[model samples]
Target: MTKTYEESSQTGDFLEALRLAVERARTEHSPTDGMIDWRVAAIRGQRGGIAGLNLITVVIEVKQV
Candidate 1:
């Protein structure tokens, strides 16, 4: 299913919030002796309603720090 603008925006916001939370937690609780990276590994989907699928998509990206 195609994502609506609201949905996409919400997802992006959620990811950003999560990244910030993680960074804060790491700074407070974990030692910062090494580099850190946050990334979206993948989003995989196949297109179909009730029968054979016609499309497949997978998105993957590294989050920039």
Candidate 2:
């Protein structure tokens, strides 16, 4: 089986946002039913536009073990 996960973050630092997004991708894991492989499905980013912080989104697909 496979599953898809999406996580987004808006922060002043681009790397921090990306790191957070990836860190949030997997909330939990188990030895018997854990992810064996991960593939990046998409990445989207938008400018803060002056009033808001920059937005970064990351999508990933995981293959079950």
Candidate 3:
């Protein structure tokens, strides 16, 4: 079965937030079954309010190779 991973990050820099979100997804991934196929399912960004920070979300899908 395929597995889905979701990660989010908030930072003042847009690139930083995206990098953090992707890093989180990679850190949480388990490769127990062997080499796996992975893809980015979605990327979302939103304003975090008065602070002007950005909230970034990344979704990943994975399955055994």
Off by over 4 Å in 3: 12-29, 51-53
Query: Best candidate per TM-score, number?
Result: 2
- Which 10-residue span in candidate 3 carries the lowest summed lDDT? 12-21
lDDT value, candidate 2, whole model? 0.63
- Candidate 3, residues 1-65, lDDT tens digits: the string is 66676667665354554555455545666556534566777878788568786777777777634
Q: Candidate 3: lDDT of 11?
A: 58
Ordered from best to worst TM-score, the candidate numbers read 2, 3, 1
Q: What is the Cα-based lDDT of residue 3 in candidate 3?
A: 67
CA shift at 20, candidate 3, in angstroms?
6.0
Ranking by lDDT: 3, 2, 1
TM-score of each: 0.30, 0.60, 0.57
Whichever of 1 and 3 has more lDDT, that candidate is 3
In model 2, which regions exceed 4 Å deviation?
12-25, 33-35
lDDT of 2 by residue, 1-65 (tens): 76766767675454565555455545543445433467777788887667775777777766666
- Candidate 1 yields a Cα-based lDDT of 0.38
Best by lDDT: 3
Location of the lowest summed lDDT over 10 successive residues in candidate 2: 27-36
Candidate lDDT scores, in order, read 0.38, 0.63, 0.63
Clash-forming residue pairs, model 3: none
